[model samples]
Target: MNYTAMLHTHTLAWFLMLILFIVTVILLKSGKAKGGKIVQMTLRLFYIFVLVTGATLLIWNFYWATGVKAILAVALIFTMEQLSTGIKKDTLQGSRPMVLWTQFIILVIIVIYFGYFVA
Candidate 1:
């Protein structure tokens, strides 16, 4: 894909992931563990999409900002996996909510940073 198309796909995947994450969080908060499973699966797919497209975008020019964003994106994926696993095993601790929110906030910050400074 062209750079423009790739960038759009990357952004779309990012937004979709964020939306699904929010929905998953809502389901978890509402005690709908079963319902959140589907969304989490979808989120995982988006994570792959984002990673692939992001790597494609960076292949042409290796910039520090893109590198940082890529690292942060991987971290977000790990956080998501951890949170989901904890939720699934019913081992969610009191600190989980804090961790979830903090990760989400970091995601938004990265998004804004990319929008204003990187892309």
Candidate 2:
């Protein structure tokens, strides 16, 4: 919590991001992962929103995306976009749960790196 630092990745942004993730978690838990088109579209919208916000964060919070963390950060963002597209057409490369788990892990790491390293 350095008082002098200015940032857009503050509590509110992360909270909104968390809400996006949580909505996905709930959808999956509802067995909506295989739900009708509406559910799938809702989930996709959530993912797209998350991806967009992530890119916005990367742009505005460029200070965080440096060193090895920089590469990881970009890869994470790309993966989100890839995932969103994959799910859009239901042509993901592997197991659905696996992708969801991997996405969760990536988000966790990005959040950690952003909070501790970027600042």
Candidate 3:
């Protein structure tokens, strides 16, 4: 596919992933493990989509700055995954989830900045 189309797909995938992440967290917090797990699984698929399209975009652009954005994107994904897992397992107590959430937000901001303005 062309760069424009690929970029749109990547954006859409990450948008949906973000929505699903919110839904999953809500469900988990509401004591609906089954529903949360289902949504979490869907979110994981979007994570794959985001990663694949992101890699494609990086391959097309192939710059050091884009590489930095890609790394930040990966880190963002890792934070999301870890946060969700901690929520599911009831391990992220007190300020732990807050810390992860903070990391997620910061990484997302950095990635978006690099993606839209820098790269």
Scored by lDDT, the top model is: 3
lDDT tens readout by residue for model 3, 49-94: 9999999999989999999999999999999999999989999878
**TM-score per candidate, chains pooled:** 0.83, 0.45, 0.96
lDDT per residue (tens digit) for residues 39-99 in model 1: 8888888889988888888886577877777777777777777776676667877887687
- List residue ranges in candidate 1 displaced over 4 A: none
- The candidate, 2 or 3, that scores higher on TM-score is 3
Considering summed lDDT, which 10 consecutive residues are worst modelled in model 2?
1-10
lDDT of 2 by residue, 1-119 (tens): 23223334344444554455455445544556554335545545654554555555456556634334545644554554455445545566658748755875776677566557664
Ranking of predictions according to TM-score:
3, 1, 2
Inter-residue clash pairs, candidate 3 = none
**What's the C-alpha lDDT at position 6 in model 1?**
88
